[model samples]
Target: MVLLIGSSMFAQSVSAADPSLAELKKVLQSQIELMKPELKGKVKDLSMDTKMSLMAILAMHSRYSERATLRQVMTEVLSDYQSVLAGIMTDNPEHTADSARRLANHRIPVGGLLPYLGMENISDERLAVLDSFNSSVEGNALKLADAAEAGDMVKAASLIGDISSGCVGCHGVFRSQPGVSDLLSLK
Candidate 1:
């Protein structure tokens, strides 16, 4: 809410002057950077009791409800990746590189969550798994981008599979509908 209010104020200031898109983006990025430290402080070094409290608060976040957009972006990037592979197989580096660049440049808001640390350096194990998953995804995405930029279709082809594995693995763990309650399943 604060951020939105701040952004609106910033926008109002610029709207009268008709700032360019690039200028608005720069202002937005600067505002976000200014907020980062304060934002990070809120969630950092939480106690166990705080974690429990946060669980209640977070229950209202609609995170699962938000996954559809993430999935759609992933599908688009994956589709571009498929064309990249086809281009590689057909010995068309230009097509392969073009598609790969398209995949690399895809952007969206709210990619996903990262792991959190608590007061004693403890973390939520589930979020830890997601952090690992995100790392794998990021590394593979970078490699895929680099390979494509260098017109190394063979490398890009291999990376697409690796990146797909990261996505599949994360979805399997977090997105699956379980047959039993975790407590009952554990027993």
Candidate 2:
């Protein structure tokens, strides 16, 4: 597959350098940018695990800053979400549907999202809540795609709000840490 080959080539090219975290992040970002067009073209066909596996390869070979890698993945997801919103605003059903599919299939973080949010202790009850949050977002994203494909713009628009709520609820639960508020306020 192209993804594997790209990662392999990238690994070979960088292996001798012993790149710093910043350099590694930079290379990964560039690689991601290079792949974006190809990704957009085949988002619907891409399995949910594709991006994750690619990132895993990079992480495995590099210093592997989990937060930075997770942030990069989230950045890609944000772009897809923006495209979906733009499509809705412009009444472009095809774009909306495609972007929604991308959103639904965005990669899981290296060890999953909860640990990144500092929810490392993940009891069964916590996991159930996490699963609920994930289902809400993924399910709504799929429904959004269906609505857009069916030309039901109104329903698609409503699903966007539901998806946002799901994301916000999950963040509120996991990311509302003590330093987060201070960090957000910029001291």
Candidate with the greatest TM-score versus the true structure:
2
Which regions in candidate 2 have their CA more than 4 angstroms from the true location?
Answer: 1-68, 176-187
Q: After superposition, how far is residue 15 of candidate 2 from its true place, in Å?
A: 34
- Backbone clashes in model 1, listed as residue pairs: none
The 10 consecutive residues of candidate 2 with the worst lDDT sum are: 178-187
Model 1, runs deviating above 4 Å: 1-68, 109-123, 176-187
Clash number by candidate, in order: 0, 0
Among these predictions, the greatest lDDT belongs to 2
**Candidate 1: worst 10 consecutive residues by lDDT?**
178-187
Please provide TM-scores, in order, for all candidate models, with all chains considered together.
Answer: 0.46, 0.55
Q: For model 1, what is the alpha-carbon lDDT of residue 118?
A: 20
- Residue 65 CA displacement from its true place in model 2, Å: 12
* Model 2 lDDT per residue over 57-130, tens place: 33433323233335566677689889999999999999999998887777644333333444242233333455
Instruction: Write the residue-wise lDDT of candidate 1 on 64-124 in tens digits.
Output: 2112234455566678778877876886767776776666455431311211122222244
